[model samples]
Structure formats: structure tokens, C-alpha cells
Target: MPNPCFSPALAIPAMMAALLCISTGARAELGGTMSSEANSIAAAPQTLLNGALRLRTVTDAGNTTINEYATNTGQIIAYTWQGPTMPDLRALLGRYAGSYLTGAAALAPDGNLHASRVARPDVIVESGGPMRGYAGRAWLPAALPPGVTASDFH
Candidate 1:
């Protein structure tokens, strides 16, 4: 913005304030509450499953929303409220639901969802890859408890 009428310094600040206002406005729409409190409590369902496969922020910074939820059934679900019915991901991840999982996940350099196993970080790949990584959300090998048929859910 090198206009004779506009100052670059002023432009930058104005842009920043506008961004802040928009960011805060989005939060206000979410009831003006930071996820810090809700996230931990909300993540409990995953913890109780395997304790090992738990929700993790994609990275420590630059990410404001929760990004991933690893389940007891060796599946990693991404969390992004971008597309239609992304809110359904929560119900799909319900305690009784160990099947469907689709949130927002970026593809890696390999064009695959970044998935990780328990006790592993940044090492996300299955020897055979995603089970049925298509449709509304992807489904992994749902490790149903003994005597429980996988067909029961469908």
C-alpha cells in the first residue's frame, strides 16, 4: 500500500485491528468462551477409550481449534468445522460409536491423512493405509469388544 495518500504504518495497524475484531467476533459467536476449559473436559471420551489414543492439537501454535482425536480403535479423526455437518463428528465419536470419524484433516506430502499410533508422534501410517477412507467420514478397523459384531452398528 504505497499510495501517496495512505501510510504503510497506518495501514498495517488498521489491518491488524480489523483482523482482531473479526477473530474476537468469531469467538463471541461461540459464546465468547475460549476452548481451553471445554476442550479438556470434552476430550475425556477419547481418554477413557484407550487412554493411549487421545486428542492432540495438531501443533502447539497457530492452531486455535482442537485438531485431532485418536480413538481406542486405532483411528485418528480430524476436527475442523469447515464443511457441512462437521458437528456430526462429535456424535459419530460418541462413547457408543466407535465406527465413523471424519473431521478436518490435511493430507501429508503423501496425500494421506496424517495418522499416528499410540506412543507415536509424526509417524502416522498404517501398513495397508485407511480402511475405508471415503464417504461422509473414514472408517478404520473398529476394534469392537469381544463378542460384539461390527455389523451391529450399521
Candidate 2:
């Protein structure tokens, strides 16, 4: 007879709970490693590192494109996202997510969410168009790779 305290039903739920924790905990951070980056997003991205910098690009099922750039040292320094809907900014920005929130909130005090841009010394963000046509890019000025320009993000 199986132990009453360890029923098959209980075991299945326990296994699922463990998996949930593992999956969420694996989310990538701006200054984290490549392995973490691969697991952070829903789909695997094509990655290339040219000794000086690493670039990873992913196009989701909706055809939304997200590009992540990292340094040879493995720290994610910049990200560019353009798609039907804005990719989750918090997941990409890490510690700098709060800065974007604060700056965006200050835009359009009259309650217009269609503002063209939100610019700050640390974070520069711009988005436009409707939900199906949304597009934007956010980056940390201090984090950009040397000799790499903002326009290079496209």
C-alpha cells in the first residue's frame, strides 16, 4: 500500500509547483549571463557574439521582433523591441524598469497615452501607433557598447 501522506494526486501537484517556481526564477536580468537570457523569454533567440559584443534576436509568433545586446563580459546592455504589442518592459529593463514607469507617468498629464516619446538622461523610450501597429525601443545610455550608436539598434 502507498503511504497515505504521499498519494499520486499530491505528487503530481507537487511536481507542477516545483516546475512553476523553476520557470519563473529563470527570468533573465540586464546584467545576467547568456544561459539565463536564453531561458528568460518565451522563445529561443538567434545569438551572435563578435568578441566585442553579443546580439540576440527573437521574433515571436505574432512577428514581434526583440533584439538584445550584451557585452563580451555577458552583461545585457541594451534591448530593442517592435511588435503588435509592447514586450514586457519590466522583464527587459530589470532595475531600470522603475525609471521608465516614472518618466512615462509624467508624460501626458492630461491623460493622453499616445504621447510620442519619453526621454530621460538614463532611459530613452519612444512608442507610437495602435495596438496592432505598436513599435518602440528603450535603452540605457550608459549601457550601450562602445562605438555602437542608438540607431544601430534597428
Candidate 3:
């Protein structure tokens, strides 16, 4: 007798669904606490910045190295990334993803499809890269620690 519950046709879809659930659930959004996702990402030991901030670095499955800067109290304030592919902006941007998408959409095409810059009073994101190389940064202006600037992230 064959196993009715084990159809090959259903296997791929089940596996894909499982992967989607795992990826989405494992992300830690910007402007949020980092403990949960940090723990899962094989994070390096947190580094302190003059006692005012902390930096946590992690490399995702795509080999993108992401550096997340946070307040001493654990709120993520900025992120920088570089790798062969771009990281998931929606996951990294958290609540600001909509703003980024909107701002990007409003820009006139500059003939560069792979590059975008979104600047708002509360948030800023800039990214660009070629076929096999990518780099970018996103940050919250008000949340940045005193004496810390956007250039300090990369």
C-alpha cells in the first residue's frame, strides 16, 4: 500500500512554505530590539562605541555582511551591508519599508535601475551595486547617538 499523505506533488510546496515561514519569522526589524534575531544569526560579540552605542555584525545565508548599530539600550538605529546580493530591505527596514518604497517610486528614473536613494526627515536609505557586488546603508536620523554620523556606519 502507498502512503496517501506523502504525495510528491505536495512535497515541494510544503517545503517552500516552510522556508518562507522560517525566513520571515527569523528577521529582526530596524527600530526594534535585536536580541531575538541577533541570537539566531551567529552574531559576533557586541562591540561598544565609547559607551554610547553597540555594534552587532551578522552574515546572512546570502553571504551579505550586515552591521547593525544600536543604542546602548538595544534599539537598532542603523544598518550597513555589503555582499554579492542585496539584503531584504523590507525585513531590515521594518516599519519604514513603506516610506522607502514610496520615496523610491517618486523619483525620476536616472537610468540606473540598481541604485536608489530615499531621504526623509526621519529616515534615510541609500543603496547601489552591480551584478555581483552590492552595498548600502539605512539609518534613523533622530535615533543616532550624539556625535555619531551616517558615515560612521560603514
Model 3 ranges with Cα > 4 A deviation = 1-25, 36-38
**What TM-score fits each model?**
0.20, 0.64, 0.78
Clash totals in order: 1, 0, 0
Candidate 3 lDDT over 49-122, as tens digits, reads: 67677788888778888888888778889888899866777778878876766565556555454555667777
On TM-score, the candidate that comes out on top is 3
Q: Largest lDDT belongs to which candidate?
A: 3
Q: For residues 1-154, what per-residue lDDT tens digits would candidate 2 score against the true structure?
A: 1111211121222222332333222345565554434443444434453465677777655577777766666677667667875555566656766666566555544333333455677776655445566566666677777776667665
Give me the overall lDDT of model 2.
Answer: 0.55
Clashes of 1: 1
How well does candidate 1 score on lDDT at residue 31?
Answer: 9
Q: State model 3's lDDT.
A: 0.68
Candidate 3 differs from the real structure by a C-alpha RMSD in angstroms, to one decimal, of 13.5
* Candidate 3 clash pair list: none
